[model samples]
Target: MDAAPIIVHRPRGTGGRRVTVRGQIIGLAHSDRDLIEFLRQSGLDETTAEEMVGSNSAMIEWRGGRPHDYAAA
Candidate 1:
């Protein structure tokens, strides 16, 4: 796996996945759009954030679930 800086952690029991950038929690994301917004809030432009999440960029590490998988477990 790539040593990515952005991490979308496992889905929680209630819902959503915790998102972290450089080890700092950004927010919980239930969808790609939410993830993009969190990235934007972290100083990334909307277009860039969208692209990053959409393309499944190597900068992000998806754990315990595939991208877009946010159902409670």
Candidate 2:
């Protein structure tokens, strides 16, 4: 299957992280759970979604902040 890479951008003023793929915004996540749900909705299963959000998976590019960090700095 072909899919655009995921990018989790820096947290915004509302402490929500913008999730995108191929420069298209997909959704905003306030926590890891929200991120996982987005991944799941994008075709990943539960375990895979959790792993992708927890680990530094190459499929996802985390920008401006580390994983699990949702508070704007």
Candidate 3:
């Protein structure tokens, strides 16, 4: 089976943030609303967005950092 698309949050320089799905850069998201909008713009439904945001399957990365899997949290 294909792996589920991973939602990633990364810290951008100048204190901004960006979101990506399946390695494709979506858009900047500094808050939940912005993240939702980015996900929607990336063609994800509301349900999928919620799942991705709340799921332990998501990933997060900081500037000059390695990916941190939420599943470990």
Candidate 3: residue 72 Cα off by (Å): 24
Question: Residue 70 CA error for candidate 2 (Å)?
Answer: 0.5
State the lDDT of candidate 1 residue by residue for 1-72, as single tens digits. Answer: 547999999999999999999999999998888999999999999999999998989998999976789999
Candidate 3 regions exceeding 4 Å error are 1-9, 58-73
The CA root-mean-square deviation of candidate 1, after full C-alpha superposition on the true structure, stands at 1.4
Global lDDT of each model? 0.92, 0.85, 0.55
Model 1 residue 62 lDDT? 92
* Higher-ranked by lDDT: 2 or 3: 2
Instruction: Please list the residue runs of candidate 2 whose C-alpha ends up more than 4 Å from where it truly belongs after superposition.
Output: 1-4
Model 1 TM-score, all chains together:
0.93
Error of 3 at 45 (Å): 0.8
Alpha-carbon shift of residue 27 in model 1 (angstroms): 0.5
- Once fitted onto the true fold, the runs of candidate 1 whose alpha carbons sit more than 4 angstroms away are none
Please say which candidate is ahead in TM-score: 1 or 2. 1
- Arrange candidates, best lDDT first: 1, 2, 3
**Ten-residue segment with the worst summed lDDT in candidate 1?**
64-73
Cα-based TM-score, every candidate: 0.93, 0.84, 0.54
